[model samples]
Target: MIDKNRVFRVLQLAGLVGLLAACGPSFAAESDAAGDEIEVVPVRGGVYMLVGGGVNATLQIGDDGVLLVDTMQEDMAEHLLAAVRKLSDKPIRYVLNTSGNPDQVGGNPVIAAAGSTINAGNVAGAIADSTVGAAVVAHENVLTRMSVQDPPPPFEGWPTSTYFFTPTKDVFFNGEAIQLIYQPDAVTNGDSFVYFRRSDVISAGSIFDFTRYPFIDVDNGGTFAGTLESLNNLIDLTVPEDKQEGGTMVIPARGRLCDESEVVEYRDMLTIIGNYIREMIDEGRSLEQVLEARPTLAYDPRYGADSGSWTTDMFVETVYREFTANGSSEQ
Candidate 1:
């Protein structure tokens, strides 16, 4: 049976514990006002999610070294480095980012400072194109979109490695097989999720976060349907229902080891909001009207309110834009 009480307690304590204890004694420094707790925690196996008020990072420990999915903030790198050191003496070999947010890839220079190369997906392609010394790794799309931004300065770290067009990219690191699936226009353009094939665990980056509502960076290719499709694809790869709890683990960008049911709850919540927005849009409701409709009012008791930077209004806005955009596209 799922221990409901334990889950709530963890959420409560999450504001206090930070991400170090769960991973031996790695010192991951968290910023003040980042809340009392660092948002990091160990769900199952050697996979750990660095929590708090930033992007999600996944750590895979191997006899050779460690493979990190994402590292948040340049300031927090030392803490992340310390935390990893506590868990094992393994050096960080690969850093994979799911999207193009600074909070997700800001730690790149820090890793470089520590003598470890940070590998980002499409997001890092911009930096890789400009700099000669940086070891940026990513797909072609990431490379192509690097300089659409402004005075067109050279990329900081161009992709030293690239993958062809495919929904999923596979890699063998730290004695584990990791499958990275790029879901176009989800949380952000070129958003990706990491699946630990052998561990049956999914590090959902920001795609499956419980802390706040979704933020669709439209300029960067985020869409409502894309996020849903991405979630469905992930669900298909998880363990079956009967083996939850002790079975496969689903680690979000924040929070505890989520089960299939919790995932369903989140999915259903999104669906409900999507449907509500669709109905409103079909009725010729404007975006402002949809926001005022407060379709998620009933859910406020649970996923309502703000947990740090994420708020109810933000969730409503994200859903409204996505549904409206989707509605427009179908026509």
Candidate 2:
């Protein structure tokens, strides 16, 4: 009495539904007044954070003008502009991106067209520089990919400036030193962290996000080991126990301020999940078998949510891809 055809058809329909959900458009709707809304949070003395426009934007109030970090969506640009104006009359001096992901750099085009704020680091220049002249920065491998074909135009804001050199760069503003350091190839190819010495705050960008699954952009040189290494570097450099202010503050691309230890824990959780999948791969398990293993079960309560926007499966897939691609070794 088992209806095999009917059962198979039902399973097929379920599969199609899951696929559609995963591939659906990812951007959420901007606020009706997002164009005019700019929310500011005081990070410390002279530095305030303006975190609307769909992505978190940090504002460091310099003597002459304010420095901005990250812009949200293109549609939310004007709203972000409105938000910044509420903070100070000084011209916007610098707009830095912690990474190259669109959510972090997408609003660059509109924000740059509005005026001459130095979009610092990787994607910043991409947004400000002319289309033909923009540069891409990363390891030589990224350059190779760029040479074959530019990243999708929409994705390539085209960084006007590129530095494939040092792991760290420091700039002085208003008697404060802001340091930009490249991590060991985590999150994506050109992931960098912005450390504001004066505010005693660090914007680790996507490297510290808590809401969604960790996004390892393998195509852009991200790796499982690299992600953990990057987090370790941040903790060592900025979150020394004596220096931590009760809680070390971090501005995630799209969430509330997180503390230093939270980041460490996140990294450890990722490492565990990544290791579990790697073990499965080494045993010659298929991707399906790895999924069935459900290695993320232990950490699900901490990071798992119902949001299909960025789900647990996506995290598992990213780590497994990296594990297999890199020969399933320690990294």
Candidate 3:
């Protein structure tokens, strides 16, 4: 069961947590108001959601140590660490990057540096010093993208462990079975869905933003088809307790906590919009015509934005481009 009181207290300390409106290829800048402090919300089975710093991060705590999924922005590292300290004094043994976006993995250097990794010693009973911090993990594509950035990331921020060509990577950490399920060509080629099996929680990266329209990075292998497929996969992994409510909590890259039903609602919305866009493309409608059609008109009031880094217009245009490009609409 969730600790409602704890969540309420965290919310009080964190103030009004605003929904993330624009998370493009490079996440749009957020005001210092929400970024200045970190709010920790307990999920279940030792899992917690650290809400703030431009992105929501997941933490798994146990006697062994702590496992973190998606460290927020670089500027928020100090506050993030302070928030983590409030939860557990143990070192952060593992850091998982859901995507290569700055908001998702920006705090890699500082957060990792504060952690200590345990290593075996050459001698029979000696334990090696653990000043090396936590082992950062991500998909191989993440490392590739971050490596070639205009101003490369610090060495410490780079993912120390990466997996490629594999559908999933599994790690048993902090008394839970953690699975890093790669989401190919969705939000980005490096996107991952971190599932904590025992805890029944999933750390959905940029693929599922509860706040606004999904940002599909066309340049980085993100596609509308892939996004829909990843959402389907997430739904499959989620199981509801009763009446499609509760059970299998989902922590998105940004926004409040969610469950299987919310994922279904999001999936259905995307599917409906995709179908509308596809029908327009088949009708030989130009991008302008489709934009005028207002396929996402209904959802705009909730998930759409007229002005921001990523607006409803941008979302429609991207989908239109993806569908018409090389006749991908047939797919």
Candidate 4:
């Protein structure tokens, strides 16, 4: 059985823990020193981002236990589990997903099973009591897509609980009202950003990858226009702090933590690149011609398309295809 007093102690000390964590070291320096070790950084309101293990996972720890958004990959389970144990001994009440990508929900089964049983009320942190495992929650589409993969992603990683929203759905956990908002056709049809209301933090999933060009998985129901809409909606939910600097914290699928201003810059990048592609289409430029123009050249240095994966040309081609989907008649 979990200790009630211990839960309260962790909850009460969370603010101080966050303060200490924030002031301790820069994420870059710490991540460089830590090197692939799962590092936890306090965001605010007892919300934290666990980086370096796999895809970024957001942990909300409170009297309710733990509520997680995006559970990295399965291989990192033990590391992530130990990291959660470092925060609280209470059960993990819920695991929410922002994308169906393997890196996002790959650890669902292990982490969910590792969690102790809890009353349904505790799942929401203030409701009523009923027995349950740490629930896996996601948009209905994520469940559908993950179910039909070649090998079919493991069942353990599939979301046990799915919500349908023409726009968004809401859940309560760890004293925070979590909004599982949809961003259809952004990274994929299933993408949803988890907004922790009290914490003012958005676990942006892959819809807002700060690391590289927004991966428009065209084969998976993604569109440049849809991703742009997602980013604009994210900006709407953000509230900057004094001097419009840092207020609402955003934890993307990968890369450094950021605030509204950084999001705006990213949005602008997508907008500019998108408009350039649209104009090229209007000018009747072939995909090869558009690629040669290298519209993303100005931003490539900052976003880094020199290697790894997801090149700038790939992003440009995606945008070109999306904007010209109706252009066969025009050309």
Candidate 5:
């Protein structure tokens, strides 16, 4: 059963935690005006969701150590640590980020190094230590993005490991097969759908946001068709348990845990909206005309219009640009 209080805490993180990527990794989580508690809810198997200050991070605990899919930015790293202590003190072995977004990878430094009690006097040695507590992992494209972000992000919490495998990158730890499957041109060129074979869970970053419409970062190589394709791929990887309700649990970037049914609903909604936007664009309608139509009007109430920062209109605009711009022609 899902805990209501835990769900509320996740919502609190979504509405409160805000991260600034260009500011560097040395920054700390800002103390909340009234302070907030970090909450961890078990999803399936050993996978759990750490919710507090920023985006939802999937936590996998085992005898070997701890593995995280997304890390809330620096703002709530300490709180995240406290929450993790309740689970296990075996140390955080890997910090895997699904994309290059700050909210997703911001806490890499803090969470990854939780096991190391000894502090390094020199920054040089910490960077050189590869076998220790923390090892940040992400797609190679994520490294490329972090390196060219204007002034360039500091090396404090950068990815220590990256994969450029064509279809999947596999890692074996704690007697489970973990695969980092690439989802290119989806939310970003670096998007990855992490599959935990033993746990029967999938950690989908921004590709599956149940709280609102999909966030397509076109400038970062995201496209409409790519987004849908990734969603389809996520569904293909899922397996329902009984009554077609609960089987393969999916941990999204933020929001509630989803099963195969939820993914199908979300996919259908996006397809309908994307088709509507394409029809409008094909008719030579301007962005203004398309926005006026509000293609997602039917889904607004369920997803919530004033739910958070990213709005429904913003999603429509992204779809419009993806088809008409330099993105993939498959759509």
Candidate 6:
């Protein structure tokens, strides 16, 4: 008595609907304005989130000088610098890069040049090099990748300080302990999460994007599993004030500031999608069948994109390829 044919047709139509939704115009990209206006939002403890210029940059200002994280793009350096000047007249002591993406480090040359580095007094009682500028710190992999680009970044933009083979690098500035935790193969192999201990804030680079689906640059050694691991690491570093409501604040690569709870939700979403795709792969489904299955259907309404630099289809494919390439759906 069951209408088997009707049920099959209904399922097929549902898959088509999911596909259509995934391919809809990219609302995620349009919503984020990478324009001239840079909004300076204060987080706790002399820390601020500079929003605009395609990505967010974090600044910790005090009497000692400023420690800035991420420098937006090259063109927006002036706007970003103007915003910094408004907050503090002190020199920028350090520029911490989360990744090597152009949007994340493009303004390095200009921004770093605008500040002076702290140097010990020489025998002559003068500074060693007055124009040394602020120290740009990042994972050595960032310098390696950026240096080999078609048109390499400006010499001034290259990181002056790099860490590798170590899980984290730490420095004390502006009365706070800042730690740069290396997150391999997340957004890129060189991604870092900068934690301001005194401020109780973390500047999570591309590892966490509150707006759109995480962009895993497979060509650049980024892996879906690694991204999930980094998100887990983020959760580990955070502590909630009460009932998981507030405590440690997070400034994502883009979008609004968040706390522990929001991060858990994002992590859960990725985990669920990963499980769905992995199950389909274990069923011996081909890539085409997998796409048609719409593993990301539930999250499409929130993080899906049809036509952006990254899309839902792209994410699904990345996960699928990552799993199948291993010849086993282990992860």
- In the predicted model 3, the residue pairs found to clash are 115-133
Candidate 4 per-residue lDDT over residues 197-229, each given as its tens digit: 988899998988876888888778887778989
Tell me the TM-score of each prediction against the true structure: 0.74, 0.74, 0.87, 0.84, 0.81, 0.88
lDDT of each: 0.61, 0.63, 0.82, 0.78, 0.74, 0.84
Model 1 misplaced regions, further than 4 Å: 1-40, 52-55, 115-159, 241-246, 305-311, 325-331
Identify the leading candidate in terms of TM-score: 6
Which of 3 and 5 is the better model by TM-score?
Answer: 3
Question: Model 1: per-residue lDDT, tens digit, 128-181?
Answer: 222223343444555555546564323443344556577677777555788777
Order of quality (lDDT)? 6, 3, 4, 5, 2, 1
TM-score, model 4 to reference: 0.84
Candidate 2 positional error at 49, Å = 2.9
Where is model 5 more than 4 Å wrong at Cα? 1-35, 115-133, 304-309, 326-330
**Per-residue CA lDDT of candidate 6, range 161-219, in tens?**
99998989998887788999999889799999999998899999998998778999988
Note the residue pairs that clash in candidate 2: 35-79, 38-83, 125-159, 125-160, 126-157, 126-158, 126-159, 126-160
Per-residue lDDT over 61-82 for candidate 5, one digit per residue giving the tens place of the 0 to 100 score: 8866677888877777787788
What TM-score does structure 1 among the candidates reach?
A: 0.74
Q: What is the lDDT of candidate 5?
A: 0.74
Instruction: State how far residue 152 of model 4 sits from its true place (Å).
Output: 1.5
Return the lDDT, model 1, position 89.
Answer: 74
Q: List the residue pairs that clash in candidate 4.
A: 119-130, 120-130, 121-128
Residue 234 accuracy (lDDT) in model 5: 95
**Model 6, stretches more than 4 Å misplaced?**
1-34, 121-129
lDDT for model 6, on a 0 to 1 scale?
Answer: 0.84
- Candidate 3 lDDT, 1-331, residue by residue in tens: 8656435533442231222123221223332338478877889979999888557999999977888998889888888889899989987888999999888888999888988665652123324358687888999999999998888999898998899978898888766788999998997889999999998999999999987889988888898889999999999999999876789999988777888877887887788778878877888889998898777766775678989788999999998888888584586
